[model samples]
Target chain A: MNVVIGIDIGGTKTKIGLVDEKGKCHIKTFFRTREFPDLDDYLDKIKSVSDELVENLDKKVTILGCGIGAPNASSKKGTIENASNLVWKGSVPILEKLKERMNIPMRIMNDASAAALGEMLFGGGKKMTDFIVITLGTGFGAGIVANGQLIDGYDGFAGELGHVDMTIGDGRLTGLGVRGGLEAYVSATGLKRTIMYMLSKYLVVSKFRGISYNDLHGEDITKAAEEGDIIAQRAFDYTAKMMAQALANFTAFTQPEAFILMGGLTNSGKWIMEPLESYFNEYLLEVYKGKVKLLESSMDGKTAAICGAAALIWENEKS
Target chain B: MNVVIGIDIGGTKTKIGLVDEKGKCHIKTFFRTREFPDLDDYLDKIKSVSDELVENLDKKVTILGCGIGAPNASSKKGTIENASNLVWKGSVPILEKLKERMNIPMRIMNDASAAALGEMLFGGGKKMTDFIVITLGTGFGAGIVANGQLIDGYDGFAGELGHVDMTIGDGRLTGLGVRGGLEAYVSATGLKRTIMYMLSKYLVVSKFRGISYNDLHGEDITKAAEEGDIIAQRAFDYTAKMMAQALANFTAFTQPEAFILMGGLTNSGKWIMEPLESYFNEYLLEVYKGKVKLLESSMDGKTAAICGAAALIWENEKS
Candidate 1:
């Protein structure tokens, strides 16, 4: 069996895994992504850890290449440009440096795009040629696939669905300082903001009454909603409605076969999915009613990112 | 010379022409589209007109095939589905019937999609592989090209940008009864409604004061705006702003190389284009500020439809 090394660089930690062609991870490890201030030092540590993992493998396998997924990574330029979350201050020549050190083929793309490719190959999107995978993490990110190929657009910035404006006036402000963007209403941070807004606007009694904004998390809201908290339920409803509306707009443009939901929001299960489905159907045009499917991603959250990175290599090879 | 027969099926009349490989229409003719209630009769009349045009061509040419562009046409199913503007009530097997009559290769696609193919091959989009063509006629229609290919999506209904909701409230109602859609604010009909809405909402005095809603047209507003009518100018401003916002949102999604404007709205020239360009810049994300170009279609409107319908066949042959 041939194997590829997959690296998923996150704000807090970097996950490294050896992924086989079958989309299975044989060994996985992690290191603090923000600990190293120097780019070369970080690459050295990553290479050492990957070498040790490869040495310990019980079965004989040919190491093909490496695939990396990171914030703001551009496959076209082979550099990570000004990723706000990462400690690296400027554009990092990741592909050039990695290839110089490992002497093998390597590729890089934004994490969201890599995840979409992973879903298409190994998860719920396996059978779908035209679908969008939306990652509802701290912020919203989208990977758009059309005609059985990922849409890289003109500048590899094509699938920025999170930045799409959703409101006309005084809507939630996004990190990008744009008011009423979809990311302001649909992400984990957006859900927390929605709950805060609901609490301030409505005098509904709930368990989250005393929770401070900084202390609140998406999991906390899920727990509270499960325990019959009205504020938390309202928060979920608002988020689902906004997401459904955005999805409806997206449907009219691309007419995808389905929309696959991933990341923290999907953890709420039926609480979010049910409302999302109903509102999406209501908001959709008559021509598209009951045609598009809403699906939950089959990839495991912990290893999904690593698998997605590795699948990039597999996808490139197949193409 | 090799030529192809192009047919553009409109609600009022059907335009048929003989087009050479270079996209030049040699001869053209038309007939009332609704005169025959039966689908076969309509197709037969179209065939007869096309045959007459082909026979009358002064140059010796090989008639390679036929291409049809109609509202709600499906290239995949070889049928024209329910078109609100057309007299046809259900799906019409146009490709089969036409192929049976002409006995060459035949293809059919929605009018907007055919127009997009035309633009890609011969109009403003001749050099652009990634761009969007917006048809601002009575209703809004869009054709998207990404990665050098048209996005037909899963059901051949992709690129429905007109129906994308632009507001969350009771904005202008669409012909489909959906309120606050992009079409409701940007199309010729939408512009009329905007002017009407502005007339009732604002006290700005202009030549439009005496015109009833039934008597108003897009050209009237254009003529008034050109003559320094504040009410007309405001209407143009409002329409351009909404269009710019929608285009910005679209940029975030597909990040096309340019956006080509066609039909009556583009006829306003700089009046619409200047404000549209400025507002589009203001609304676009920083990364995409000066990247996408806003262009006017070069194809003549009267013959553009025929050329677009013919281009579908030319495009298919090359692909």
Candidate 2:
């Protein structure tokens, strides 16, 4: 059996897992990403944690490679470039530093691209040649695949679906400071914005009405939605409408076989999916109607990111 | 020396050319497509005209294949699906019928896709692996190239840039019966719509203000703009703004090295291109700003369509 170490590097936490070839996590561990500010110490921490996971594996498996997925990662340069959320400044030679500690056929890519690779290799996109995997977290990031290849354009910065302008005149601004962008209306942050808008528009008594901007999280909205909170439900519906319109536009661009949704907001389930499907079908071009499908990522749960990261190694191995 | 028969099928006329390896047309001829309503007769007429053009060449040359770029074409199924503008109803087996007469390795695709192939093989996109060719004619059609391949998607119905909904409320509807589509605001028809809007809104005296919607054509607007007519200039500026926003959105999707403009709207020259370049730079995402170039298609002139059509053969031959 061949297994690879999968690392999911986030702003606050970094998780490493012993991932089998089939994308299942046998063992996993996490460390505070911000705890070690020094670059060399961070590398050492990652190596120790990864080594322990491999040693803890019950079966004697060959460690083939390691794959890491992070924000602002540049696969072409083998570095994470100016990630706004990370404490590390400038272009961090992460892959090089890690390779020094553990010499393996490792690879790194944008986190969203990693999720797309996961979807292709082990999730709903298996056997599918063309599709888009969207990560709807703090922002709307996507990895678009066509001809069974990732579209990492001229500078390796292709597939910025969230930033695709699907704006209504008075749409909110995104974290990137772009106004009227799709991410401004469809991301986790966008969902909160929707909830806030609804809270002001509708006079309905909702549990979220008292919540402050800093206090609100996507999970609270999902919980409220599951309980049939009117404002929360309406917020999800509004988000879905924005998402559907954007999906329709994206369909016109690539006309992918399926659109797989991932990350925090997808937990809303029927509240978003139902409205999204109907609106997407309603807005789709005449020829594309009843053709493309909208699917939620099968690679859900905490270990999903790890599986997605590990997929990078397996994908490269095949190529 | 080798050559290919290039056929550009249009609603009114069909042009046939003997295109050499370098995409230069040696000789060309045309026949009214509407004259022969019968599909069989149309195929016969095409084959006979093609034969004459091939024979007229004085120099000895090998006929490699035949390529046709028509509305509503399908390279996968070898048919022209119900093209709303074309006389043919339902799926007409264009390639199969044409193949029966010539018996050469023939292929047919959507005209826009053919133009994109032309770009890759002979035009502005000759050395580019990733680019999008926008054909702004009566409608906004496009052929998107990414990862060194045409993004024909799973259904081969991808790259519908015209149909992409970028609607602000009150945006005009396209021939596809879709509102807020890029075609509604960027095509030749769309330019007239812009002119009409400008006429109604602006009190500035202009020649086009007296013309009816039916009487006003894209050429009139271009001519008026060249003469420094305020309404005409404003219309071009408005069209460029809409087109720039659409292009910026498209950039977020594929992030190409350049956007090659083809078809009628590109002929407006500086009236549109100057403003388009300005707005494209202005509206482009920070990551993509100053990177993508807005290029006019090098395949210009009466022979342009023929070159675009012949490029299909050369593209396939390369593979």
Candidate 2 Cα outliers beyond 4 Å, as residue runs: none
Output the worst ten-in-a-row residue range by lDDT, candidate 1 chain A. Answer: A168-177
Candidate 2 per-residue lDDT over residues B165-240, each given as its tens digit: 8774456677878888788889998999898898889899999868899998888898998888999999999999
TM-score of model 2, chain A?
Answer: 0.94
lDDT of 1 by residue, A170-194 (tens): 6777887788889989998999999
Query: What is the alpha-carbon lDDT of model 2 when measured against the actual structure?
Result: 0.86
Model 2 preserves the real interface contacts to a fraction of: 0.71
| Model 2 chain B lowest lDDT segment of ten | B165-174
- Residue B248 displacement in candidate 1 (angstroms): 0.5
**lDDT scores for all predictions?**
0.87, 0.86
On DockQ, the leading prediction is: 1
After TM-score superposition, the amount by which residue A9's alpha carbon in candidate 2 deviates from its true location, in angstroms, is 1.9
On lDDT, the leading prediction is 1
Error of 2 at B224 (Å): 2.1
